[model samples]
Target: MPIFGGSSDSEDERTIHHTPKLFTRQQSIHSLFGGGKFADILLWREPKIASTLVIGVSLLWFLMEVVEYNFITLVCHASMTSMLLFFIWSTASDFLNWERPIIPEVVLDESSFKHLARSFHARFNQILSKLLDIACGRDPPLFFLTTISLYILSIIGTCFNFVNLLFIGFVSLLTLPVMYELYEDDVDTVAGKLMRKMRKLYRKVDSNVLSKIPRGTVKSKKHT
Candidate 1:
């Protein structure tokens, strides 16, 4: 009769050993956001809040641009337009499921918050890595160059146009809300609860330490 077995005992051992390597290789790529680190916390905890903020600010900025078109200089208009475009593109991408973050909804207790913070740090590092990769890519050299050029152009443009300067100033102000949202999305998740707790603890400790320090120790030198 023909041998039913595909391989000898040694062959089976070798096959088993090689199979794991294949799995390991596959896991390497799939493990980029392993262990619930990239879960969609923002969606769970404050979807409405985030959605409203993004939509509201975006609409307001667009309206301001429209209403004050004549008041803004060309350079400032360009800068504001660029910022608005970026915001629209980013929001649309999130909506389209192309580059949406996986925010998890975890309770924000002290221990959990710390873990979330670590995960956020890891996620942020990954994002930075991807950004650097794109910046250095051969096909995108112009994108990086244009960013630098735009800043310089914006400065020169602002110098000649008060409206442009005002638009740029408004863009700078908008950054605070964007950053706050990002922080909330990253830290207000289940895995990041430990970090929030640690922050509170740290603040409490700092307060106590400050309270212990004598007020008279802070000397204000008189400038003549």
Candidate 2:
């Protein structure tokens, strides 16, 4: 049997294992998030790309949330601004006898598009399968956590608009992963203690309160 519920070396699976562990099979923070260019960007391995992404998202959040700009309106305004600038440059180049501006053609690769579509399809199926498993009580802990999470999100929905919520999530994405990576062991220790306390509390409730609840007993009817 594999230790900590991890696969063999041939599987190329790496998992974090130490005292006071909350998640037994959980991969490293980097590996948990796909562990490539995306992981690098999220973990700030490439500071330039990560900062650019943060700045872009922040600018979008400011425009959409604070400025109250509609998405379509924003796109149209940006497009018009670009066209105006290009027109001005073209006219100036002609007047000054300089070379006209060249615009690069943007083409979507067929292989890349197919790969993206297949990835989405697989991910969608995986999520649906997981939901089915959870609903079927295959993972009681996961089901309980999912229910609580949805309930919290429902409460949050009433307090913030979709754009505001997305911006908040984006901000969290930029900050949370890096912070957790920096203090992984400390966070795990705290989480492990909390989990143990919660388990004891749950056991008490199950024995004292839930166990006392009367369950309906079914009777079979017989015909004479």
Choose the strongest candidate by TM-score: 2
Root-mean-square deviation (CA) per prediction: 24.7, 6.3
Model 1 worst lDDT window (10 residues): 1-10
lDDT of 1 by residue, 79-134 (tens): 89977877877788877866744456977689877887887898798666655654
Reference-based TM-score, model 1: 0.23
Worst 10 residues of 2 by lDDT: 1-10
Local accuracy of candidate 2 as per-residue lDDT tens digits, 28-138: 888766666768988999999999988998998889888989999999998999999999999999899878889999998998778667766875886687788768865
List runs of model 2 lying over 4 Å from the truth. 1-17, 20-23, 97-102, 118-145, 218-224
Which whole-number lDDT from 0 to 100 does residue 40 have in model 2?
Answer: 91
Error of 2 at 46 (Å): 2.7
User: Looking at candidate 1, what is the lDDT of residue 200?
Assistant: 47
